[model samples]
Target: MTVRGPNLRLEGSTFGPRKISAWREAVAPFWDVEIRKEDSSEFRGRSDVYHLGNAIIGLTAASELRNERSRSLVARMGVDHVAAQIRLEGHATVEIAGREVPMAPGDISLLDLAQPLSLRSSGYRAMTVIIPRALFPEAGTRLGAAHGTVLRGATPYGMLVNNHLRSLAAHVPHFTPAEARAAGQATAILISGAAGLGVESAAERPLQRAPVFLAIRSHIDAEIASADLSVEQICRRFGVSRSGLYRLFAPLGGVAEYIRRRRLARACRDLVEGGDRAARISEIAYRYGYGSPAGFTTAFRAEFGLSPADVKAGARPDGASAVRRAPTDLPGGGWDDFYEWVLTLDA
Candidate 1:
């Protein structure tokens, strides 16, 4: 649902300089504050606040001055509350519910508004997601495991979630009402998944796990130009055992075959639309991970019944004679429509 809230602002010397003050005022509607120090000198300064979803998800990032403080105060907070904060730039030390938590880039902290908490923020930028506690049955108990948690590249789920957040930050605005609702539900599922709650429905477990696989696939696609884009390399980079990685790809053939097919498909499109007539077949083959041109030609021919040279030569006819290899079109087509297809996949 489209969330509605008051039009609010924060102003005054509470944010240090006039420039920073203006920014603080703009964001004050969503964050309560107690600024400790205001000097240009860098030292521990403290700020106290809680974030609503608007300030948490809508803003790309918020800049804040460092502060040093100690206090525990929260009132009327309920079970249906969760706050997700990720450091976008700069560092912040967060202390929540009596625990010391250090935060850095790609790290996510789940704040429980029901309990007393404090945050020690240095010069920093961050994104936060506040979820209602009522939405999660095991909210309080599970939140302890997620509080002040660090989500870095070290963990597969962490990387996947971070990547999802990055993607969402860029596309959240384009989401329609239905898409937004779905996206919100997906967000809750992801949080639960990360928290080890295993709260997904029977139908959602697969898609919930799809992010990690999707992350790997996207990584492979971007690195196809590299000669060492092998399944082994992917396993090593993502910390998945060879067997485990294979299991993740079993539905789409084997990992090695999947990479080959993807590369060949991309090469097909490039050969047809890239307008590089003089592009050497051997060069194109090697560029797409084929060590030998002959092997590439064989695979290419097998995939589309046309050799690389024939395809590049435009020997494939344009109409009914030639196969117009493409996926099924949606009722309403484009990216959002394509996402419908994506959502339908077991992934």
Candidate 2:
């Protein structure tokens, strides 16, 4: 059955025996999932997913699942999202990069979507946060090698993040679009913190540069509305060399491109989903640090392939039109419906 707000809740009973294949197809966008049972029998599962503006949060309960690296699923899927899986019940093991990490209830681990892995879970329940790689540029290398690295959920940071995820999953439906967007940003920050990439004192600094990069990103998000926000300013604030800053943001198409893309994304959300319908295009552009309305319009059209006016006039951008037009009438059931619901959350 459907839940209120922008969510998709599904149960394996809806599709009965087909749940096995449905599960496979549902995750095909992110992984080539397979169900493995001791005996050849039907599989059953359930999941609830919340479409935060920039991240996808899911609470899932399922029977056993198995993925072997020999299957070469990573090559087949070419996934680009990272899954932070937090266990709520049962146990699971993930083998990645020749290391095996097992999770008990309350433990969490990060899985690199692009890497080959073998994961097996018993009858299990979990909360998963799937984040786009572009959002966490600092964590790129760590995440790439984070296959079996487990974060102890009993730790203070892990507990805080776990509770936050639980609360976000429960309250996401009631959040206004702006709140959802804010929550998505908060989610990224929390995940980074949980992974030991938060701002650190000199004595606590790790060898990796992830913490520094995370701090830089947090600052950029905070000052995005300022016209003077620039790489030079970031360098001054972070005490990083221009070359070092450029190297950090290289994967994200360089720092300036990242800032422009983020600002435009927020502008698009404001144009289509903001509560203040009376807000003008120029006002929206100015709010995101665009100095000129013409420049904003040109950049907006180029990035989204639609004029800001078109979006403000209720013309949805490309694939987004379907969700805005019919949020409730998504076709199919089980995993297919879940997959469609997930796609609507894309920015």
Candidate 3:
């Protein structure tokens, strides 16, 4: 028997404008996809998504695609997974540290989902595996060091990972559910091992990472509703220097800003989707770590351009209206499940 959850497929050519709309909805959780104007009217692509227990793997082929993910969106979405991709065919450039680094066929790139990412590619096929950052606690340092860097397929470890990914794409779809789950765990463990392995000395500088960075971020998320979530508390709990912690989160607009953005974003979602329970703005503010309702109101308005009341009162699309993608199944696929999976894939 063959199933598509661990082996689903999407052919964008089958739908009209709805195809593009549905694709946007699927990617909205992470990227702000910008299809070239020329390709917008008639977008074409194919996606084979796999569920690897601890990972969501995607093999995508597209025509002239550019995806822009900003720091603001990063804060709003707060999906901190590690996205590792290998270019199979065609050319793509991923912007890192203000530089557009190109990926040729057979190259690997590691990206941090918490940071900003902008990728542009034309007529390309690549496989991307996204896993939660918390999955590999032991190799946080190595993974941190790997962020924003590309590994040439020519390198020893790079070649191994590249081939391993290709094999996974070829065989994972046929595995039974139990087999897939075990594969997912193996994928995480193997990737963690690879993240720890050093590349040949002359190839690239040794990868380095702040040991406590991911753990601290996790702690913040776990404690966002608490007033005790101060920068000092984080430093003491993680046993890291204050300056080091600051530097680690500088890309996300500082530790305090990260927390505030996360709170407001959570508050925004709650107001928009919290149902009857969200009728009171004060309750929403208090639920998200705000001491003063007035302060929460000020910050909320500044970030979302509307009061919590506005969202709750249905000024913006919410609840049923927010399900803009596809209520009924579309031709060649069912995107509703895909959208939900993107939001709920913890590993």
TM-score of each: 0.43, 0.55, 0.81
Write one digit per residue (lDDT tens) for candidate 3, span 50-150.
76556778999877788877766788777667777899999888875566677889887777777776888978999998876667656445676666667
lDDT of 2 by residue, 281-345 (tens): 99988888777899999988887788998888877652231223214432223444443444333
Please identify which of the two predictions, 1 or 2, would achieve the higher lDDT against the true structure. 2
The alpha-carbon RMSD values of the candidates against the true structure, listed in the order shown, are: 22.8, 11.3, 4.6
**Alpha-carbon deviation at 44 in model 1, angstroms:** 17
What lDDT would candidate 2 get against the real structure?
0.64
Distance from true position, residue 197, model 2, in Å?
6.7
Candidate 2 segments exceeding 4 Å error: 1-6, 12-16, 37-42, 67-72, 137-142, 197-347
Clashes of 3: 2
Model 2 per-residue lDDT at 341: 45
lDDT of 1 by residue, 1-347 (tens): 32221112232334335544544333332334455454432222222221222122433333454321111112111122466666767776665434566777777665544333456665666655656543453433465335445555346777777877767665655554456455655666677666663321111122224445556766877886788889889998998888877766654455776677667766765676555544788988988878799999998887667887887777541110122222232112222222112112110
Strongest candidate by TM-score: 3
- Model 1 TM-score (2 dp): 0.43
Give the whole-model CA lDDT for all candidates, comma-separated: 0.51, 0.64, 0.70
Tell me how candidate 1 scores on lDDT. Answer: 0.51
